[model samples]
Target: MGDTRWLSAEEMRAWNAFLAASALLNRQLEQQLKDDSGLSHPQYEILVRLSAAPDGELRMTELANGLINSKSGLTYQVTQLEKAGLVRRRTCPTDVRGVYAVLTDAGRRRLEEAAPGHVAAVRAHLIDVLTPEQITAVADGLGEVTARLRALGR
Candidate 1:
């Protein structure tokens, strides 16, 4: 190797901050969701996605992609939801190989119950702690990073 470039001190600080914030936020939100509605974070997200879809459903592949989760992981979560009467999986008529995850009425009600606590936790832990400029900076910076990573097909 001819040369190597490592993160600068400032860059290291930024990276560490990001890692810590994301991990802590995820943990807190997960706990809130579990305690408030007996739903895991991923399950709640699945319900939210389906509830917003045209027919309260989406193909399994599409749901996995949108969630940035592994197909197997999504499958397990969907299965759990199905058993709980919160969701159902149906084969697509036009495409036998495709499966759709549909939110049940119970799922929607669970989401409505979970959302308030989740949003409040998010606000208390992150949003309300930031100034308007910091909020904008975070949104723009993270959005750009997410877009770039997605563009790379990762």
Candidate 2:
């Protein structure tokens, strides 16, 4: 068997930079959403996904997958959102054991209110700092990474 290799200096720098940028961007976005709309970033993501879904409803399992969350974790979040009047749960008509998370009107309104500030924060904090060439490079690099990760799940 071959011994494992570790990252080189350049690779380490790139990996660390990516992690820092991702964390900072998430924090900034989360803060903006909390300040402006009283919604956490994860909650905002759930609402966004539900709002985009057909009939603004998705099976709990499906929502969990879309959020990359464990079923139990997603259930807890959905329950919290339900308490906040942002979402509701319904039994699936076709499947007695299935539950659906339905985005409420309040959730839609909250997302609509939060979106502009979130986008502005993203643009100001990251996109505005990048050159067009850098933007293209980042898009290409991240696209490749996403593709590779998706392939691994097959």
Candidate 3:
């Protein structure tokens, strides 16, 4: 306890900026996604991930890990998507305990419909606001932060 050192002014400023920006950005994107396609941010991400996967399918555990989400959370979201006819879950034939999330045709269509507006929202909120140098700096800096945290089992 005695050896604990608090953040300096600059460090505090950086940390605060990161926290606020990330939160606001997530909020903005969530709203944009919801408005554009009646999809939540996490749902949209699941669709995007599955769309890019081979055969538009991935294991439930893989999906959960890829999204940094809990298995149960992913299950709930997958179930929502399933109800919407946007996704389906399949039992892995070789492993009774394994399940897969498969993107449906409707999911791909919805993603295609949603992509342009989502891209524009992203540009309007973040990318277009930054210079190339700032973008690179952000990418490199956050990339390192993500790598370190992930390495720590985040």
Candidate 4:
């Protein structure tokens, strides 16, 4: 291994704060989603992604990639959604080996019902706490990190 470079006190403080905030935010969001919509945060995210896709559908591989989930995990989530009548699997017309997760009418309705409460929770926990400038700074800083990670093929 190469020589380890330690973080400075300031850097460590910021890093820890980021970690704690991330964990707490996710926990809160998950709890809120579960309580309000009987859905987990990951499930909500899956629905959100499908809702935004063209024709409210995405190939299983594409959905898994976008969600950063393992194939099996994505399949399981899709199965759960399917059981709930929120989504259905369709065979890809152009690719016999591929499957698509298509959001059902019920899925769209569920998402619509969940969105308001989710947005309110987000605003209450994060957005309402930050000034406009701070929000922009946070977005820009995270966008930079995301770009760097993607560049590294992470």
TM per model? 0.97, 0.90, 0.97, 0.94
Runs in model 1 deviating more than 4 A are: none
TM-score attained by model 2: 0.90
User: Tens-digit lDDT track for model 2 on 1-154?
Assistant: 2686888999999999999999999988889989998888889889999999999999999898888788998988898899999999999888999999999999898889988988898899999999999999999999999889868973
TM-score of model 3 relative to the true fold?
A: 0.97
Candidate 3, residue 2: lDDT: 83
- Give the alpha carbon lDDT tens digit for every residue of 26-50 in model 3: 9999999998899999999999999
Task: Using TM-score as the measure, name the better of candidate 2 and candidate 4.
Answer: 4
> What RMSD value applies to candidate 4?
1.4
Candidate 4 C-alpha lDDT tens digits along 87-150: 9999988889999999999999999999999999999999999999999999999999988987
Clashes of 1: 0
Candidate 1 local lDDT, 26-109, one digit each (tens): 999999899999999999899999999988999999999999999999999999999999999999999989999999999888
**Count of backbone collisions within predicted model 4:** 0
lDDT-best of 1 and 2: 1
- lDDT (C-alpha, whole model) for all candidates: 0.94, 0.91, 0.96, 0.95
Residue pairs clashing, model 3: none
Per-residue lDDT, model 2, residue 14, is 98
| Candidate 2 deviant stretches above 4 angstroms | none
